[model samples]
Target: MIIELKSLDEIDPCEFAYYANDPNINTYLRNSFPAPYTLDHALSFITHSLQHHALDFAIVVDGKCVGCVGVTFQKDIFLKNAEIGYWLNSQYWGKGIMSQVIKMLCSYLFSNYTIHKICADVFAENKASCIVLEKNGFIQEGYRREHIYKDGCYHDLILYALWRNSDEY
Candidate 1:
């Protein structure tokens, strides 16, 4: 299948909401990603992405927007770092789409920005995500026990990091 990264503005909010409405997709994601995602939520998110000129991009598969990958830039003394995040439609899982998407986004970030490190915080139970990060040369740097509160319960968090010098990147 063809996979590409496209600007969020190029995606239809209805399509985005349709794929993101699945509760299963939000299990490991931050609470900010709403359950039963609506078209309005997609519009708001796309607007914010456009306004900030953010590094966010739509994960396009076979010309259809299937998901997104982006980074949150750090500031102050941490200005050289960015926290990466991503999600894919469950239908696309295990097909290696996310691993490729992460690599593409990381390469773009490294080449276009002055950031030296890309990091990710994952719920400890999300083995698939951790594996994807590892495939992209992200090393687990820390593990915070019960650091995430989701769905009314605490979950462990795994911190992974990749440096600009990583040969794979």
Candidate 2:
């Protein structure tokens, strides 16, 4: 599957609403990405991205928006840090697309911005996501036990990072 990145405008809001509403896909992501995702939610997301100039891109695969990937450049003392976040449509899980997406996005971020490292947090039970980060040369940084309270329960969060100037990465 040839995957490409584009702005959210290329995606049909209805299709995006349909895909983003999947509980399976939203499971590991932040609670802000509500399930039962609606067109209003999609519009809100698009509006926020446009308004804030967020570095977010829609993952287009086989001509459909399968996911979104983005990085948040921190502020103040954390200004040199960029945090990455992503979620794929459940149907595309085992195809190795997101790993490539992460790699491409990481390279783009490092080249375009002044940053010390890019980091991501993965829910402990999400071993697949952890593997993806590891495969992309992101080293495990810390383990926050019962760090996330989502879906009515607490979950451990694993911190993983990749340095911009590291030779090993």
Q: Choose the strongest candidate by lDDT.
A: 1
lDDT of 2 by residue, 1-169 (tens): 7799998777887777777888788788887888888889999998899789999999989889878898899999999999999988898899999889998898888888889899999999998899999989999999999999987999999999999877643
In candidate 2 the C-alpha lDDT for residue 161 amounts to 94
| Steric clashes per prediction | 0, 0
Candidate 1 lDDT over residue span 61-111, tens digit each: 998888988889999999999998898989889999999998888888998
| Worst-scoring 10-residue span by lDDT in model 2 | 160-169
Note the residue pairs that clash in candidate 1: none
What lDDT would each prediction earn against the true structure?
0.91, 0.89
Q: Candidate 2 at 44: error in angstroms? A: 0.8
Estimate candidate 2's alpha-carbon lDDT, on a 0 to 1 scale: 0.89
Against the hidden reference, what TM-scores do the models get?
A: 0.97, 0.95
